[model samples]
Target: MGGSSLRRLNARLVTVGVLLVLAWGGIGYRLVVVQALEADVYADHGLDQRLQREILAADRGTIFDRDGRELAVTVDSVTFYANPSEIEDPTTVARLLAPLLHQNMLDVLDAISGEGTFAYVARQLERDDADRVIAARLPGIYYFTEPKRVYPMGELTGHVIGFVQADDNQGLEGLEYQYDDSLSGVPGELLVERDPHGRTIPQGEYQVVPAEPGSDLVLTIKTEIQFAAAEALQRAIDRTGAKGGSIVVVDPATGEILAMVNLPTFDPNDRSDADPAAFRNRAVTDVFEPGSTQKVITISAALEAGIADPDTIFEIPTTIERGETVFRDSTTHPSELTVTGIVAHSSNLGTITLGEMLGAKELHRNLYAFGLGQPSGVDFPGEASGLLRPSEEWCAVNCVASTSIGYGVSVTTLQMAMVYATVANDGVWVQPHLVKEIVDGKGTRVAVEPLQRRVIDAATALSMRLMLEEVVSGGTGGYAAVAGYRVGGKTGTTEKYLIDEQRYSEDDVVASFIGMGPIDEPRVVVAVVLDSPRQDDSGGKGAAPVFAEVALAALHQLGVPPDDR
Candidate 1:
């Protein structure tokens, strides 16, 4: 009986062992089928459920002035990102990143544990903060490089260099916006593979198409001249207690703008906190009612039309009758004034009488020919084409007479400078340029060419120059005279615009002066306009001094020998 029972027990043990071996073999076959036969399908499914792809931004271009000074540039910065799936301790990660990123712990936790596999913890982190984040080494938290634009010069050329947005590299104002496409280069791409632990595999096959940096832009502005002009105008505005001011200096021969400055300028580096009005490049944008400064154009037109001679004598009077309005002389001279004396003295009565000979139609035509009432085509944004009503819109003989003295029409400071430059350059109207050239990423240069046109005959320009020289030699713009330099210009003080279209307020007036140096062979033309100065200030007192200061600065820098020397 014992032998039979032992044999049965041995048989039962053998049966159990065989059944266990068969079951194990079947499970192994199923595993081989799932892992080896359908490997690619399972891998794709896993990637689709947890993997994501994003863009890595490219660096922007560098902006330099004519002197190779850095105006705008892109710098390397760190940005923090998170992967919620791999965070071991959400509270610990939040606390670690909060102080470094200057973000609340709750906000960091929300970003880390959000629905997406990837989320931004902080962008544009400072160097110190980036180092702290890297030191923390919190799971699922990391940083990569990005770009930001840096403006070195504060408000010196803020209007010229312009500004860009902080988040996206897009130009917001001025030349930056005008030349944005050339500055913001094409962005590149990067691909990464992450493991179950949310760590990027070091050796993962990454397809990185390196980005192309944007081409560098070289401006036509001379940095030194720009700084000087800006500083000078700022001083003038402060001293005169004027509302604002603008000045432009142009090379009369070549028409290249040497310096362009406007007061109340903003610091481009901190443009985010500056006033919006300070961003205006007023030299090219603001149009004002140019007073007696326009007599040069009228006299030139009259001479060009064979209407009057430089020696033509017009009997001077206290006032002149034109239909209903009476145009009077600012001075109390009661003697006869020659055409030269009329221009030299800036006699509104004498000049209007001379313009009366041209009539409204011819006067308006000449004004249009002088680049007023139209765009000067300077390479900047928001340029204004000053107002010059058509001859058909004139009310009476006085309307025509008023325009002859530079009252009815308006012009930008740049346009006025160009007008004087044209006269100085013998009537050839050259278009102004801000950007000189565009150098590609590979150092290939694409030059920006300028345009030139003829505004009047050379003979007419010469006659006008002589008359303007008299204006400064012994006339209204006497303060603008340079000791050794033969200077010629005109002074203009116009009543400020009445916003409510009511009676003129004695409080507001725009004082301006436009002049050129070394009248014999003019090198540069300067135009300065100061708005709403305090007290009873005229162009001779307020704007003429500024013109003289800036002109002397330009002369000193240009190394022109003074006439007195």
Candidate 2:
């Protein structure tokens, strides 16, 4: 009995030992898998009282103007945050911070007494203000370095250089949107170890990868020219009691936009109180009936096709009927007026007759050649291609006749400027551009150049120039005169159409002027648009004066020598 009992007890002891070892091995394997293969899944967070890791955000980039002037820049600031769960006395802390932040005490207390471990107390506070808040010793409140964008020139080029939003660092409009890719850089990261007090330990192990700030953009706009154009256009708008106004100045040689502005422009600094319309860049964005400014196309086409010469006589009377539509001159016309006279007088009857001789297809070719019915490709967002019904949609005689006289269609002021610029540039269609250069995050620059494409013959351009000269000297655009320069341009006072969501018909008016000057060797092309001008007869009176005033100012500012030739 003794031998059997001893053997059984020894065996039982060995089996128990083996079972314990197997259990220990199984637990060790499970722990290894959980910690190594699935560490991120299981250990994703830090507990309420334990120290944890946090991130330090990198600095954002800055923006500068063409002349290396600070248009927009980021300044170092602080963002205040609170650990609501750590605050001992929420009411006391709120009372101290509410006045410092100018926030409601109740709101502050609510933020501090919440169940969350962290919440924003204040963001983008200046250094001085942040220091004051830090000195107050408010419980559970802390701050870190932040970047805020500031505009040095206020609203000077606000329309061109758009504003950034609160959360998003990229541009929302204008050249900002146009060149956002080059301007926006990748954000950097920082791994910071925090203690129980929610403060970073200076000696703690930290992993920091410095941030690369965004690139800088240099635009073609001249600040002084921009300011001058804005002031002059604004003055005209005020004097005429117009609802709104727009002006664009372009280098006729290269098609570089020097100044483009729309009245009621906003200040990018404080955008909260600005009207939505103030953000719109009307020169390239807003479309309207071009009226007589479009007559240049007809004359150019006629001259190009040799359908009629300037001296060719047409017995243009008053009104002429085509199908159901009756086209008439602004004033009664004589029985006989030369082709040049019809252009000078802006005779609707005469224009329609000439346009008809060119035919619809030929007329459309001329308009398309002039850069109509497509995006101007300017460096700005939200630019419209404008409304141009295909020639296939033309309703026989009525549509063709109206199209001839600059009706039944819409175009942007930028497009109108291009027509004059093309003539001034001897018929070369250069793509309009705003950005002159792009500077990368590493301070490297890539320059831009003019994209030239010829659209008409040199002979046609010269002939058209002479006709436009007639417009400024003896025709509707006479008011846009420079005393010493060989000024030439056109006037357009189109009836603003009343429309529903589907259709439109004429009732109101949008007065505008398109011109180029020192015609002997043209340098600049400018166009001014006054929407719904009050107390003016036509574009000749409402818009021509504005164009002349701006052109004169621009010439004087640029020190462009007067043409004594």
Candidate 3:
């Protein structure tokens, strides 16, 4: 209506037009960014929401015995998993899977009940069962191919080969754990584009990066010898009413273990209810006082130091005292005995006298050189170094005397077997090992070259072998003699040390016998250890018989000629 008002309205309209132009410019800039400049990045981001990356499992290796028999192996297996949150009806799904999975419906229901995204309904299922689960097509239940470790020998080689985890197939114990890296090859990845409901989209982006398979292991275990040892040990347990036992057989010249078995073993196939204690390989992991079986080391030490020979004479007192401890021979013997006679009789005073000649430091050094006081450098996992304190610590009280008589020192069955193996191998100490070779997926071969060192001179070893022969022929180890073979060995029985109580058990004892057969060219060394036998409890009676059984079988299996003629 007024001239001033008309001018104001035109100015407002111009301002509005400028505002619209700026808004359009900003919109064009945004459109260019979304359509062209960052288009690839945005497209990738959107696709990422649908893309799923999955870990592809590698195939585990196989374990073979010396004879190429499959001791442990892996096969294709199926595992069914579920996302409880995604499950439409847990009860119905559980019901469908229970019978096929061989699991209780209630247990399955509980596993699939929670809001968690993942739960294992059943692991390591067979193809038939897995196929049945697939046919059910229960929502939220997912499955993919996974490996399952199996032991063909069952409890026969349980403690040695060990087992792996069911789902991830990770090594859990024994040689499997020892060489996990070599056995577990590189894993791969799989990319899959999925829809909103977690379905694989049709014609969606999919790619697979292949997994490299693991290496295979070949052990030194002779199946025949292993079976013989296992059977003998089991019979020994039954006859003696013993808690358990262990047997170790080795090739004296090569340091390769032939047979290693432990009782109280569990099946590695399915360890759902297996006691963890059954997993221990006692020959390598546990230790015990060696008793008279250790006399060889002392005698060999004396011979090595030129302090005594097999015929060297010592006057043995009936009872000898060091500090408050008084030591006596297990059985009555003459007042004086030559070194050979002393070993045969297992004279405590005689051994102590010889130990005084070598002293503690030299003895400890020799023992360490023999692979005691340290791990045997075995290829198996969880090997113990055994208990050998520093030599300087032994000068106090009757430590030296106790050690000489095999009361203070402790050793594993494998260690003791290796000790006798040294004497059998012309006084050379070699690192004992179970794995003979490992072949990888790349066709690379890994052969075992065991460590070797001379523990004693060849002459001393000859003398020690002769002295041990006398033990089996006329002494406490009479039961350890192998038929048609000139065998040599030592017997040991010691009070069981109770670690939990920090004391020795008055009643329980560890009975053991370690021996080698075909004495002139000793081929086999076997160590038998029985735990807490009530009847036939002494080493000579309980463990020696087992040693004979195993040694004979091993010798025969190796096609060794008998020297009885």
Candidate 4:
């Protein structure tokens, strides 16, 4: 009996020992698989929970006028953000931020209570307001310094300087859009470790790639002259009840634009509510029939081609008939006039007679050479290449006649100013430019060189200048006379063309005047164009006065002494 019982007990004990050993082996294998084979996977999972990477914004560049006046600048601003997961009470946080940010409480609450890990409470806050938020010491609330673009001159240079988008700080228009790459600096990055509560762990896993700043632009604009031109243009528009207007002042010798101003402008600092039309750099973007201003080109072409001289006689009837079209002067005039008289009076019929002598090919060539039917080469966005049909397109007699008197052609104010600048510069057409220099982040300065080419002979330019002088002295542009300066310019009054109707509006007209002063040695060329002035107003009475006011102010600002004084 003892032997059988002992044998059974020993067999059971052996079975239990074998089962225990197998279980221990399984446990050991499981430990090895988890600790050695999948160590990297678990470590990465932990890092994903504790580490955060953030982008740092780089500072934008500044824009300055020729006299070092700051037109556009970047300033330090703060952006408020919240960790929704870490926020203990979204309602309390929203209530605290509502008044400071000028946001509705409900909106703030929704943002803070969102499902996202992070949410922006406010962006680009003023320093004082951001400091107040920090002093409140609200948990889960933080702020980071960011760069903000601002225009100090407000609406003075709004069109030219343009503005940046509020959401991403990207350029939207004008020089800002054209030179965005140079103005936008390289962004930076930061890596940091955080705790479960979303607080940065001190001195833990920190790395930063520093940001690089952008280059500064120095413009050719003169601030005082720009102000004067803007004020004069605004006054003209208000006085005449015109829709809008533009003024451009250029240095003839250098072809550097001194001032470019357009009315109905907006403040770049706060442009979100501005009309889209106010954002356009109208002097370069908008075009109109140049009216009698085109006569300067015609007369210059005739004189240059040797087809006519200043005294070339023409029997200019008050009304000229060509097939189905009939052209008439602004007013009834005598039958005969010299080329000089024709240009000074801005006679449409007389200008057509000159065009007949030069023919379409010669006329088109001269207009093209004067920078007509082309972009003004300004460093601006959406610059227009004005409409000028090719010489071959001038098939009809009306086409030839209309082209001569600025009817079949359109030009930007900048182009017309450059045309007169060409004459003032003695027939050498220097391409106009706005930027004067670029200052890099490392403090390196680079000067911008302008493009130049010959368009008309110096002798022809002199004759043209003398003829234009007659215009301001006693002809159509009499109101453009600047006291103590020898003024020379032409007036243009043209019926506005309706694009949809494809016909000229009898009641609406564009009044413009282009002039250069101190004719003996011209220094500045000014162009003024008023859109759709009252019917009683014409180029001589409307735009010519504006031209005089701006030209005199510009000449004075440039320190050019009066020639007649």
RMSD of each: 5.1, 6.1, 4.7, 3.7
Each candidate structure's TM-score, on Cα atoms with residue i matched to residue i, is 0.83, 0.83, 0.87, 0.88
Runs in model 2 deviating more than 4 A are 1-61, 81-122, 128-141, 190-210, 332-335, 501-507
| Residue pairs with backbone overlap in model 3 | none
lDDT of 4 by residue, 257-322 (tens): 999999889999876698987888889999999988988998898888888899988888767889
Please give the CA lDDT of all the candidate structures: 0.83, 0.81, 0.90, 0.89
Off by over 4 Å in 4: 1-56, 81-97, 103-120, 137-142, 188-210
Give lDDT for model 4. 0.89
The alpha-carbon lDDT assigned to residue 286 of candidate 4 equals: 90
Candidate 1 deviant stretches above 4 angstroms: 1-37, 44-58, 78-145, 192-204, 500-503, 561-565
Q: Model 4: what TM-score?
A: 0.88
lDDT of 3 by residue, 315-363 (tens): 8998889889898889677898999999888888899999877889988
What residue pairs clash in candidate 1, if any at all?
Answer: 484-562, 484-563, 484-564, 485-563
Query: For residues 373-428, could you state the per-residue lDDT of candidate 1 as single tens digits?
Result: 99888878899999999999998757888899998788999988988998999998
TM-score of 2: 0.83
Q: For model 2, where is the 10-residue window of minimal lDDT?
A: 47-56
Count of backbone collisions within predicted model 2: 1
- Ranking, lDDT, top scorer first: 3, 4, 1, 2
